[model samples]
Target: MNIYIIIPAHNEEDCIALMLESLVNQTLLPKKVVVVNDHSTDNTQLIIDGFSSKNNWLESISIQSSKEHIPGSKVINAFYKGFETLDKNYDIICKFDADIILPKNYLESLVALFNTDSKVGIAGGLAYINKGNQWIYETIASKNHVRGPFKAYRKECFQDIGGLKASIGWDSMDVMLAQYYGWVVKTDKLLKVKHLKPTGKTYHKSSKYLQGEALYKMRSGLPLTILSALKSAISKRSFLYFKNTVLGYIKSKNKNIEPLVTVEQGKFIRKLRWEGVRKKIKI
Candidate 1:
């Protein structure tokens, strides 16, 4: 089956090249690589263009659509734009960041999993920051709404989900929608990759992540979603992750949460917000 990878990049010139190099070295290289340049002012687009001209396997698309100029909407628009342009014959499509470096066998493992399991709709690999020994499992789970850096989805499954939601929590929205539709999503712990530490300010600020979660949970029906979150807490490292989510829910009632505060930060508040009666989203 043919495999395609879509990278949504905005002002990521420094790291995008490294990621592209890894793709060239993949044991099971993707049939095509599409990098969506989201109106970057820097040389990010130039970098992609340089690679695409030299590497027949890589193709870059410059997207300056007005629909993608908004906050969360940009990512969803880029994702959908890539999905629309990607070759239809490809069986699998992967969504990844331009800052990540793939392990040599990353694509190999994903292709194997999809080929072996007919029921599997998406397979995500482990993502670590820098060369740090620690795994940001909780952060990745809450941020991307699933495993980050290495998410591969079946093309048909993606189409069935109506693509991605152009909302506050686009990444998590994608994974949750897959689960809601009975699609099997699996994480391969053995398959690992490095997300190079971002230099200067990062958009991945914790407050933004939590806000995404809060907005996502509210938009997608909080009661059932919180129950699922609780299940995630119970199943994975009950003491640390699960308890944290539960506590975050309980604490949201008292005050506005702080920045960089993960679900683990104000555990009770998150739980409270998830279970609140006026949890419906505004706009």
Candidate 2:
């Protein structure tokens, strides 16, 4: 498979080198790798340039964007900047973070997974963050979910879902939309990737309510949005998360923000989410 990767990075001088090194040393190397240097005041560009100079397949592009660490839109916008430079000749296109280290066989395993099943539209490994001294599974989401930090999408499936949404719930929306379009989302527990920086470490406080807004945009409806918020609060053990999430939903509802999915797609997503909830509780 002709795999291509786009890494959206901002002020990641501490970890970007390890990430690029891992990719260049992959068992099955990517055909091309583009790293977007999004308004970094640090040595991030220097590190990327050093690697790019040594490796012909690796390259970097700079874009001016807000320095504030907000999620979703900022990162996706940077992703498109890198995405625009690549040709549409890839079998698997990956949107990876600058702070993660992939196992040497990560790409090779992904290719094997895709080759084994044609219906698999999205495939990725689990993320493990270093805690104390041990690297443990990041519990922000279910093991079944492919983290936004490292996602690989088959070209057909990526196109079917109209690519990723430039919104707060873009990561979750991609998976739901893929399933709605009959594409299998697969996660491999064995291919553990090292997450150098824990998720949401640098997010601005103002971005807290974005999660609720995301549920609203996904047309999760009031009931599902509340349930989802409660689940998140419980998982993270933060009541503020629950409170902010509900408030965010209500605010978006009052403003009547445009939804990311169509009515038909929203219905499918609602049904899918409800089914998952029921299955989890053995209803």
Instruction: Identify the leading candidate in terms of lDDT.
Output: 2
Q: Scored by Cα lDDT, where does model 2 land? A: 0.94
Q: List the residue pairs that clash in candidate 2.
A: none
Q: What are the runs in model 2 whose C-alpha is more than 4 Å off?
A: none
lDDT of 2 by residue, 186-240 (tens): 9888999999888888889989889989999999999999899999889889999
Instruction: Tell me how far candidate 1 lies from the true structure as C-alpha RMSD in angstroms.
Output: 9.3
TM-score of 2: 0.99
Task: Report lDDT (Cα) of residue 73, candidate 2.
Answer: 95
Q: What is the C-alpha lDDT of each candidate?
A: 0.65, 0.94
lDDT of 1 by residue, 1-283 (tens): 7888888888887899899888888887788888988878899988888888888978888878653234455666787788778658878888888888888998888878787778678886766664356644434343322453467889878876666656445555466556556777776677667777532135343332343244433342345446656555566545454444444444543344332223432343344445543444432
The clash numbers for all candidates, in the given order, read: 21, 0
Badly placed stretches (over 4 Å) of model 1 are: 65-71, 131-139, 142-145, 197-201, 204-283
Q: What's model 1's TM-score?
A: 0.69
